[model samples]
Target: MTAKLPAPITLTGRHVRLEPLGRAHVPDLFAAGGGDEEVWRWIPTPVPRTVEEMAAVVDARLADTACEPFAVVDRASGRAIGVTCYFDASAEDELLEIGGTWYARAVWRTAVNTEAKLLLLTHAFEDLGMGRVVWKTDHLNERSQNAIQRLGASYEGTFRRSRRRPDGSWRDSVYFSMLREEWPVAKARLTERLHAGAAVPA
Candidate 1:
């Protein structure tokens, strides 16, 4: 709570636009991946079965002062495809964690995610002046861990039984981080991938 996170802002890129999340995004979001178990597999929340449920999820995030949530909009179709956020920040330490991210099944490994992260990381380091950006994912989610590493984050270790999953099972969280000093190289690599369309993000 010590960190002063930025107010919600829109970040536009060639493949996606990250706009402040709202109830208005529920429908497109629901259409994008609602009721699809795969899309919500790694998300802590249970699969939202209805637009109303999706609205509730969006509302919950809006009510959390610590979170700055964004609805990821695919530029080509002008539809919201998913959500991501910035939370768990500490201003005294000049650090923050970016978690609560999930994209529609269709856009899973496309340039959409690559461009979106490029925009977010640029803002986090250059605009917000954060010294470090962190990420945490389920220990069993190797695909996600790989994705984080692809973004140049260094694995920091794991927090055993950090939280319970939606299914009520204990979950161990794996942590990763990227310091400001490492952003330049990571940024270059991310930019190049975006320029290349990053079809599968090898």
Candidate 2:
């Protein structure tokens, strides 16, 4: 018999739902991320300028074996607000990287983002038995870098001249990681922070 593949995983958190990418999500995802030039400022690929382009990008990602993207839905509103992926996965080494994440300005710096990330990291280290979970962003993306630090991941240094951006400029990649041993304290702190933030008045 063929070895069984892991069942399609759907991770639900308090604030967000992570569903495996599918054609059904294309329209919402396009609306959520398409035509947002600011979202793509630090990334290589241009934001999808049209629905068709968004669909094509999602299709390509679904077809790739090395990476799997999920549509991040805000449970409170039942709307897809962004995308995130487990890429450069190494099952043999029990490693995975979370990247390609982008959310709308409305949700940025909100409880939803923190809860969503808490869900992803918990699943990676606790549920999937990953030894280490990695995160990376453009070196110039101080916003993202700060978010990573806020999640309690250790900064692992930068890869200088890692890749060329769409604008023909070289980009440095900053890396961060949370090891299995660090998950307990990290998760507790993240949980406390999210819960505490939720109680604050606007």
Candidate 3:
């Protein structure tokens, strides 16, 4: 497989669709996540107080070339409910990290996140032909750590005081990675979960 990064493209799944982030999503984005302290706790930026602040955050991510941000739209409601991104890409090594993800409180334990990861990992390993996909989270964030581990990423170690959080405090970053060989099982597990979701009645 050649070393190449995923281009900007929409990834559609049963539960959600990943579209390029844009200003048009501002209203739904804000409605889904804005002003929620718990939702923004692990995020690097402060909780957005208004729609404009959230739009500013979107604009900043759009301006950054190192990342490709996407609006996670729930297919059921046809509204933007979250955001995720493919960042820190290294085309030479066929490596990249999927970070910068957050969702509305309502969809926290639902099929939304599971299917989103399925779509992303599938694109990374199968479509982009990436050798590795990395994930990182604050050491103190146990929920995030468990989520990454559940996705079949091996816990790699922590970088002490890796970066400063929005609160001006040091954050230890715990890293994890899933190699190409491990994707099949992970993909299977995610697919099963999504199928289970589809089987349930509304």
Q: How many clashing residue pairs appear in each of the predictions shown? A: 1, 0, 0
Lowest summed lDDT window (length 10), candidate 1:
193-202
> What is the Cα root-mean-square deviation between model 1 and the actual structure?
1.4
Best model per TM-score: 1
Query: Each candidate: RMSD to true structure?
Result: 1.4, 3.5, 3.2
Evaluate all candidate structures by whole-model CA lDDT and list the values in order.
0.88, 0.81, 0.88
Question: Any residue pairs clashing in model 3, and if so which?
Answer: none
Ranked by lDDT, the better of candidates 1 and 2 is 1
Model 3 spans with C-alpha error above 4 angstroms: 1-6, 198-202
Q: What is the lDDT of residue 88 in candidate 2?
A: 72
Clashes of 2: 0
Instruction: Please give the lDDT score for candidate 3.
Output: 0.88
Off by over 4 Å in 2: 1-5, 198-202
lDDT score, candidate 2: 0.81
Model 3, TM vs. native: 0.94
Worst 10 residues of 2 by lDDT: 1-10
Q: Candidate 2, residues 132-167: lDDT per residue as tens digits?
A: 999988888888888888788899999999999988
